[model samples]
Target: MTAMPTRGAGERLWIGTFLVLGSLTAFGPLAIDLYLPAMPDLARVLGTSDSLAQLTISTCLVGLAVGQLVAGPLSDRVGRRWPLLIGVILFTITSVLCALSTSIWVLLVLRLLQGLCGAAGVVIARAIVRDMFEGHRTAKAFSHLMLITGVAPIVAPLLGGQILRFTDWRGLFVGLGAISVLILLGCVLVLRETHPPHLRQRGGAAGTFLSLRGLLADPVFRGYLIIGGLQSASLFTYISMSSFVLRQEYGVSPQGFSLVFAVNAVGLVLGSQVNGALVSRFGPERLLTVQLVMMCVAAAGVVGAALADAGLVVLLVPLWIVMVGMGGMGANTTALALIPYGHAAGSASALIGTSQFLVGAAVAPLASLVGTDSRVMGATIALATVLSLVALWRVHHARRTTPAHSEPLTTTT
Candidate 1:
């Protein structure tokens, strides 16, 4: 068998490559989660309504979705390193601009720009992984990436809340700016061009569109994309509603709320680590099937607890289960989706990332519409999980009926 390409010469270089790529992947999560504790303060300080403050988040999501669509094909046409570096530079500049904004409108605009720039890292990081590894190794690399990326949510809110104790909302953006600068330095020092000129897509716009259409037409890609998007919506539903539910309704303090968020994040981290160990044995498809079933059961438990007006423990336990299931399923589905499209990994990664964020953006606002009680949040999650189950079943059925020679390429072996 042919060997997978290595990013550097030794184990140390491999570890460094993973850390840099993982940090790049963490950019979006850090951007979203780090200032969540300050959302109320931001609304008050900027003289904006709660919905408008929340719009900042939704707008950022929109930018993230759109930015990936642009950057993905650009990376395919050009190369990964330049797109990544330029994105990091833009992210740093916009973070500083976001810190300096005097009006909510200004902040919203800057947040959109920040998200746009931040997306280059998120999409390109996945493509870089694809360039360097294939098959089961790709799945394994993603699990490690998840471990690194998962730390953002686990620590960001906690750190942000503590920062709020010493400073205001503006300081949060300043910190984000500083983090971006550090990431930029790391990228400059360590990141190499993974996508080569010989392999790059030619003919620019026409070629890009053709590649995108082909990916969309693939049944396997469609199945994984739908599954990923729906699963992500479940998490975003909780994210959009959790602060209000825990802090406003349940009377938890911001610090306490951060701790609650961290607990669930720990479940995600554990799940990713477990999946990493088990994926080589069971294969990503089998693992994803089991995780989806668990997700449905967990969603049901959440709905039942919410309907009963149960205590926080009942709500949190099921929510943690849902998080764990999502954490395990996300990397597997993404790896499966991109494995067959190695030549267009950037575009494939972009589509997956964009769908996940767009679904998240749409689902997040529904929490407020349905009323931000536990039941509404739980029901939103249940709905997403139900959709995910249907998608999973369709993929399973399609695989069963397809001829062995016609099966999509997977890195299971």
Candidate 2:
């Protein structure tokens, strides 16, 4: 069932396929990160309160989470290519509308639309990979896609800041629109219909619901989902609070913080590439076990560093290891979670994406409610990784205890 490299022969075609899929994976990150530097400017231009301006981000996050639930199932129903093409085209149009927005309310609506449309790329790209590859090869493909998602956070803000120096917030939206247009071209050029008519699901809404319920009932799949969701919870907590913690607690300059952020991102990238190289040798299950344990230890160290009022270097060292663990675990968990659901890869991918965001969104503010300080951030991250480890243990235990014949199976139409 593996996909041949798209539209041509040899090594170059494979590279092109990877690039297009990687670009698809970048949609959510690009939409969120690319305009972050312009938040204050956006607030001022629209004559809105800072809190209201912040709502734009929240709205977009909501859109991303909800949109996947729709787009993923839709892709399964109709086949992958047209949903993706239409979604990207609509996303581009929405980005243009966002750029033209003069009111906060209007901009918020447009951002939400952008997230909904852009979500097609995020979910369907993973679905397409699952449609093509299996086992360790699936893990490898995901790791490469993760390279783009991992790099986006690092590059987008810096690039956005530079864009701000040249033009206003509206210009940033225009830039986003341009980026999507390029992705749209890539989609049209490289992507083929991986989910064909014979393989496509029928029964419409009822089928989608049944597919989701069946996936949820499988303990192995559910465990992987929980593992991924909690890992993302830890990562997002760091993302939400790290700048403030580093600046306020350690007296780091903005430039110093950016350097530290980039360093951590590079660690993440390194871990992902390494995981891809090792998965074939070590296996995703074994690799996942080791990575989660490492993350648990490193996350606990972050709590210790925060409590002891340690040096900045001490705190950062553990954080970097956690980032690395996150990088490795993401592809592994996703690859494993999706292995059993090729018939519903879109739905499975959608659940994975949605759960990560929903769980992160839920947990991040709880940490904030406690405090935005280093101690709270560290504890939240530690708690998340520990929970992830527990979920992994539970998964293994269930597998060992449950009879093979009784294990739940995903029903494919």
On TM-score, the leading prediction is 2
Candidate 2 — which pairs collide?
none
lDDT of each: 0.84, 0.87
lDDT (Cα) of model 1: 0.84
List, residue by residue over 235-287, the lDDT tens digit for candidate 1: 88888799898988789997798788888888888888899888888888888
Error of 2 at 337 (Å): 0.4
Error of 1 at 308 (Å): 3.3
For candidate 2, what is the lDDT? Answer: 0.87
Worst 10 residues of 1 by lDDT: 4-13
In candidate 2, how many Å is residue 272 off? Answer: 0.5
Q: Model 2 reaches what TM-score against the true structure?
A: 0.95
- The list of candidate 2 runs beyond 4 A from truth reads 1-13, 403-413
- Give the Å error, residue 97, model 1: 1.9
